[model samples]
Target: MKLIVGNKNYSSWSLRAWLALSLTGTSFEEELLPLDTPEFYERIKLLSPAGRVPVLIDGDLAVWDTLAIIEYLAERFPDAGLWPADPHARAHARSICAEFHSGFPDLRGQFPMNLRREPAPHPKGATADRDTARVREIWTTCRSRAGDGGPFLFGAFSAADCFYAPVVTRFLTYCLDMSETERAYAEAVMAHPLMQAWCADAAKETAVVDADEV
Candidate 1:
């Protein structure tokens, strides 16, 4: 598997796909493409017509889009349990992933993940606050589902957790308010070995996206 991504410090979508691959315990090659570069459009054109980062190349097959890549991997590696074991839990996880994937443009625009940066004041506004609240509500509900066995949503660090990994990073980066449970959950996600590796790589990246530099 060759996972193509963008600047680790700036690309939230890339991070999601990367995390899903990591969870499979499969060793794969990585291609880091700096965002907004001439080389990107030219190089990605052959890999994915969408010209997007987070494209997974598996031999002759190429999967684009973060969610699609994850789904493909899950089907390819069913034993890895990319999703939950229970059908209900799995459905909930997928629903949450969908929500995270497409429903919070405002929060996403306001809180770009910057792993290299420490917590700081976030922008304030109605949309921002509403997004934050919705995220917290989702976290609360998911944690309730996790019960006590695991710290991740639906437990066991499934695709749902992968989908939200960037959100956790964003919360910490912006120093956004989180409840005790929410903070614990976020901290747990950060402490995961794979997440630590991602953050370490992100720290080593010198590239910057000006628009994401808030």
Candidate 2:
């Protein structure tokens, strides 16, 4: 299996699929392409239907889209327990992941993911406040309901957590004000072994995209 990703420092969707694959203990070759580069477009277009990163190529099957790649990995490695065991919890987890995939544009545009940057104050009227509030609501609800098993959103680092992991990075990058619950969840995500590994790699990367430098 091979996974094609974008710059570790800026590609949030790539991080999602990479994290999910790592958590599942899957061994796959990684192809890192610098975003917005001619090389990136040329390379990824050969593999992905949407010309996007985080495309998974297993044997002859190519899966694009972060959530779809995650689902494929989960089904391929059921022992990884990417989703919850309980039917209800699994359903709720899927719902949250879908919500994350479809919504949160406000948060995404205002606070792009940059793993090496320190948190800063939020800019006024920049969607930070509303985005932070919505994220806090989701975190509080998930932790209150399904966080008994562990520190993660669904307790055991399920696909839902993978979907939201980039949001955690964004919160830290922009220094978005978060509640106690949200803060704790962010800490847990940052401290996860796979996340730590990803951050380390991102920090070592020398290629920088000017657009994502902010």
Best by TM-score: 1
Relative to the unseen true structure, what is the C-alpha lDDT of residue 48 in candidate 1, on a scale of 0 to 100?
94
Candidate 1 stretches greater than 4 Å from native: none
* Candidate 1 TM-score to native: 0.97
RMSD of each: 0.9, 1.3
lDDT of 2 by residue, 26-56 (tens): 7889999999889988888788779988899
Query: Cα deviation in Å at residue 15, candidate 1?
Result: 1.0
Best by lDDT: 1
Which pairs in model 1 have colliding backbones? none
Task: Name the lDDT of candidate 1.
Answer: 0.89
Cα lDDT listed for each candidate:
0.89, 0.86
TM-score of every candidate: 0.97, 0.95
Clashes of each: 0, 0
What tens digits encode model 1's per-residue C-alpha lDDT throughout 1-214? 9999999888889989998998888999999888888887788888998889999999999999998999999999999899998999889999999988878988888787888887788667788889999999999999987887798887788899898889998888888899999998998999999899888888898977888987
